[model samples]
Target: MHRITGSHQVQFLDALHRDHVEVEDRVRTNKAMGLARLPSKSWRVNKGWVLTCNLAADLDAWLRLLTLHDDQELARAEPETMRLRIYHLPARLACHARRRLVRIERTWPWAQAFTTSWARLTALPALT
Candidate 1:
């Protein structure tokens, strides 16, 4: 429970509490994404590591927002889950005619989600 001074309406306090919770959630996620450990003794090296972690977190957020929005499991997946199921999958790119194709085992559990994400990403307009 939090104690607040002054007269505040219930709705306003609840909204403020929710916003704080959301920020705390993000901080927890960031810690899980590598902010929990500072592996280097040097300040510069630690700064670089933090930057790398931030980049990875941004990429993860984008992946969920852009490609995995329709996939509930993947949209809420943790970093390690995404890595094991999607990023580190055994797949091969094959050139057939004028198009490239991704070939993966049909029996793979998350194969459909992976292929759907790939197709969605490939269908995006290229930047000029």
Candidate 2:
């Protein structure tokens, strides 16, 4: 687990952990309710990377870092841009998945897809 500091960060981390459980439960429930097909075992691997710490701080920092990196890369716009874009992809995907899930209907199929995508995205390796 990541070291959490500050009460707000701790609270956010706790909520994140709880949200992971809730998502897993909802996925199981959807399967039981015959709402959506469960993803394969391979897909489940993504759950391992689900948020264990408060990302609100890290995400804010990442965005700022990305902006700075992007500015520097834009001047070169070749290998640098490609590298920077690849580095930023995971964060972009996570943000997109979060937004998608927020608007997704509570139906079983949509829930399953949302959960699967969310899990897979979070599990993606960070840039070296």
TM-score top scorer: 1
- Top lDDT hit: 1
> How far does residue 119 in candidate 2 sit from its true spot (Å)?
40
lDDT for model 1, on a 0 to 1 scale? 0.85
Lowest-lDDT window of 10 residues in candidate 2?
48-57
| lDDT tens digits by residue: candidate 1, 47-74 | 9989888888888888789899988888
Candidate 2 lDDT, tens digit per residue, 1-128? Answer: 45546545767878889999977754453333332333335645434323312243244334434433434533223333333443333222224744742344344333443344345556768999
Q: How does residue 29 of candidate 1 score in lDDT?
A: 70
Which pairs in model 1 have colliding backbones?
none
lDDT of the structure predicted as candidate 2: 0.43
Evaluated at residue 14, the lDDT of candidate 2 is 89
Model 2 per-residue lDDT at 82: 31
TM-score of each: 0.79, 0.22
In angstroms, the error of model 1 at 75 is 1.5
